[model samples]
Target: MTTPHTVAPSERPHPWDRDAPHAHVDLDALRHNLALLRARTAPGVRLLAAVKADAYGHGLLPVARALAAAGAEAFGVATAAEALALRGAGVPGDVLAFGPVRAGIAELVAADVALTVAQPADLEAIAAAAAGARARVHVKVDTGMGRLGLAPAEARALIAAVDRSPLADLEGVWTHLASADEPDATEPDSATHRQVAAFAALLARLERDGLRPRWAHAANSAGTLLLPEVHHDLVRPGIALYGQPASAWLARRVPDLRPVMRVDAPVTFVKRVTAGTPISYGGTWCAPRDTVVATVRLGYADGYPRSLSSQAEAGHRGRRVPVVGRVCMDQLMLDLGPDGDAELGERVDLIGGGAPTAFELAADAGSFAYELLTRIGPRVVRRYPGT
Candidate 1:
């Protein structure tokens, strides 16, 4: 029943006057990815789409609504503020905050946001906050992640303490996977399998003690896609929902996945440069021969990586061209090569739409695909329903 048509268009002003760089988000592709993941996920395993870090920089509320309509039973954010924001925006369904809450407990509880009792002390504080109303809680058990969550031995007692309290509801229990994307999914001795085993044992102990949350989840996009055994009641998929692969291994597994966010800009200026013409800030790249150099209004300041100096490529006129200089704060130069018919105001894809993909560009910059998408500056306008 959920579809992209249910969401309203954003009223933010776009850079329509010139060749200003903009991020075009393909909502249809997002829905497609969601359907693909849902189709593969075990039946009865509800999906909780992770929309933290502004939905991995594709924009939060927009992505949340899209996924919710696409059949996500719940949504996950990294902070209480993110959960509150979703509630404020009127996003229905459960909004679980997976990270530590820095804000007041009353605000989150009143907002109906789920809290993670990672430690024993957190249980006492949350119980105190739930004086009049129930504070939905999710107990984090550190089966192996070593970062957050209480010890397995400490998890049950804490959950018991919270359950006895009149103001809290232990709604869901979950964990993070450290190596689900490494060495493929077949290695029996892999750290991911070990962590999964530990988690299973912990879950068994909890069940034996007659302790269970309404929802039990422990699989991210990588784990959900490869290991069906780990997809208990809910599978929270983050980057994969954005239509980008969470890892190279996942990319291979889900070959039909699409890229939803595309960075594009119009040709601001095109000039015929003579041989030996130095480009951009440092004279790092010079014209090997006389060619048409096009100035693109995209740079490191706009969330493009500067590490791609003289090594990046852009799409123009149905072919690829090289980024010929050190990318600047607001602009970069592209060597259009001879016989180029690029003109001013012509739309050129900088990172998608058949150009160097965000993953390929991020790889060239010695970074991850997450960085490339989330780092895109706010100055770059975003257009939805993009081709």
Candidate 2:
């Protein structure tokens, strides 16, 4: 059987000791978001808070604990290490490993954390590790995402093998939806319904063989909001529960979702430059008039995409200021315009209230908010306030 104990203690150095720039995560907002996710689920549906990528760069263990205390039924992570960290932190609830677990299988199964099985060898290995310790395994069917899981027929055979194994208990079957976040992007129809239909077909096949799992899920945050019909037995709420909506559907459906992180940086230097003076590398930005240029310590290295140099805005004492010039690796400059009152050491809002939302940042940077949040660098200090 898989060993129930393998994870060591957390060794991460403090992530908030940086001097350049920082991002603060509000625990109150985290709690609020967790409550919102809890409210969305039906009476018996369990909520799995996807806390992978260090809880989307907000710190995994703490975020997981906050979610659990707020009523999340489980935690979902991308790696076995993350799962172990959650387990180490004493997070109560299921911790699902979404990615490959190399040498950590024994420890993972021993800890009673659920793992996703996509390949036959993975199934065999997990079964061997679990032995008779009763480890719950979720079968991931590559319905439409094309990323993980076995094909429909292949998935059935794998499930049968897993069922026959004494080491594993078939806990759930899940599929991912790729187009759920943006259904009307190109085609005349949303592939969300198609993905859901495929998941349903796979589940139906599993049921036909008398394989009734304890859970059946296919909804990511977008799926939960855009396609409520696919809520299934469990709902995996990731970005949505963190307060940033996955898409327009989530914004419309879940109006109460609050953003949890606010990225703020101090204005290192404020200088008034003439109209013709260029700002930062390559003179990419020229002042329309004599303006106050505020140099900010935040940059692409800190998860503020360089592509947003021209489109991003920061709030200075509640006044919106546009970003000017190219965002460098360690610093960026903002235009306080011709008439400016911003001073040195003034607080600038990068991703918080009175500032642009993560949505706005994604749009400005030509990417997804999920990527933006998860890519936030470790150098940025995360301050969790209002416990």
Candidate 3:
């Protein structure tokens, strides 16, 4: 008799699974990227995993949980609501709110999420809302990034104001780098260096005024890997954690940054078309010879860009096939050549591991990896594997 066998309940497959389009997020790969960053960071510099934009479209709660397990010291979000989401998920880590205080300043204080006071008004609002509550905050000096940050002069005034407020706790001083991803960023007088120098000067002045925040951070993904000087006390890495290279320097420095997400769709139909037959809408692409066209179950509405219709290629069975004609809102046609052999129900790799990467698709679409990941539509379900 055969040996007695038992199938664990966990081994059972999903009941409603079928050929469908979905984005796969590898929890192991996410953990790997965070661990790589921790090893590369400067000594005593903590890691603040940037989970804004739904962890750059890799799923917020899943990515946050993985980062926490990988030893992330804190999380960085752009809004109080994003921070609160982390707290609601029982995410046990310091959440630093880096965006401007548009609203809900008190709610952030209530959630124990730190704030980035970029202006005097923000400080006043936070101080009023934080009355009798120790409101943790990181003063955001503009430095050189002309975005949502207080200028050096204004930052000085705000720090002084915070000093007078009993409800405020100056936990950190931080800035955003504008060109740390650019070439020659570390060169003398480069924009990246200039930003860091400006931030350093502000920190010195604050110290001289007898005010000090325990945390001082400026390095983003690029700065964290390329410039050590900007790694003041903490580094916030965003795209890199999701395994997309944040900069050319990081790509070269850390060669093992594994991409954690892949877009996959099942081939819905395969049809043979005669020569001169136009494919898809607009008749833009006509077959030069009899060809087999495979239609996959993804479209512009699913985050597959229309711009990639004629410019990019999708992967099928370890082969490359050009996308032909206009990408419809619900489907697109792939020119599989005369001898192309994609069977129905076979999985097609649109963007992800061992296929045309998000970077490649972005370059073809004249965009960037960040847009590709974040633009993936909500209609497509996201599956996390190997957790």
Candidate 4:
């Protein structure tokens, strides 16, 4: 006799369950990418996955948890709040805030989050906030980024100051590469090479002076992929871990990385239009011939750039359809050809999967993958499959 079937409880609507645009984050792909990146580093060189900007808009906690399970040695974030959030989630691994902490210093110190001390004032503030507790810190040397790091000449003195602080633990030293993603980055005369040499010189000086920190890192994703010499003790990989090459040059060097995020939207409305009908705002694009216009529920507000209004294509059942007219704040129209078969409720690939990759889409929009990925707005639901 067949057993009685037990009905499962009705679950609440997930981000993907709603009839709207959603981002499908493939956790398996994320883990695979992490493994690939790990394989690129030396056996002893650790990897600090950069999860800043909500893991490049792929959801922070989910991405961090997945990476931790995949054996990430550490995580790099841009804010103290991000670091604290990781700790609150019980994520196992070191969480380093790449930016200097402006607030939540005591909380971060309590959470064991490693902070970046870029200046003397930053050190003073962190030491004061430590309250006699040992606060982990990584000193940031300008090296050439000219951003939030202390001058190379001043970095040595700061390291000494950190060592002298009873409440501070100098754990590492790192520098950001300004042009590591450039095409000629590996050239001896390139800015990336200069930065690497400068950082190495500083480390050498620190070693001679008995002031070298426990860890030294100066490689971003580009440097990790191309300049193995800069791998030093740890590598901070950001865009590469998200399955995006840091540059076109790096893409050619490493061609096996898989994209982790796929953005898709349901076709909310579809209509047959005449040749002269304008599809969206400003009457910018008039159909060249009788066609089927499908309205996708995605727009600039959802991180689909308005600049991609007339230049992008969406993938629908293996066919590339042109995006006609200006993309709206909440919707965009796709020209599905005169004999198009796209129906309402069907999903279209706006990015990744069968559509143009994020890199390609960013290029079409005159931007880069970093900006495109991080700009994915909150309105778009993020769903992680197989998490």
Given candidate 4, what's the lDDT at residue 346? 90
C-alpha lDDT of residue 359 in model 3: 69
Ordered list by lDDT, greatest first:
4, 3, 1, 2
TM-score of each: 0.94, 0.90, 0.93, 0.95
**310-381 in candidate 2: lDDT tens per residue?**
778888877888889999988889888887867676678888677888877887788978899988886676
The per-residue C-alpha lDDT of model 3 at residue 162 equals 75
Task: State which candidate has the highest lDDT.
Answer: 4
Better of 1 and 3 by lDDT: 3
Better candidate by TM-score, 1 or 4: 4
Estimate, for each residue in 286-313, the C-alpha lDDT of model 1 and write its tens digit.
9999899999888899898999998888
Which window of 10 residues has the lowest lDDT sum in candidate 3? 1-10
Top candidate (TM-score): 4
Rate residue 95 of model 2 by lDDT: 87
> Global lDDT of each model?
0.81, 0.79, 0.82, 0.87
lDDT of 3 at 205: 88
TM-score of 3: 0.93
- Give the residue spans of candidate 2 off by over 4 A: 1-20, 128-134, 184-189
Residue pairs of candidate 3 with colliding backbone atoms: none
Which stretches in model 3 have alpha-carbon errors above 4 Å? 1-19, 248-250
Q: Is candidate 1 or candidate 2 better by TM-score?
A: 1
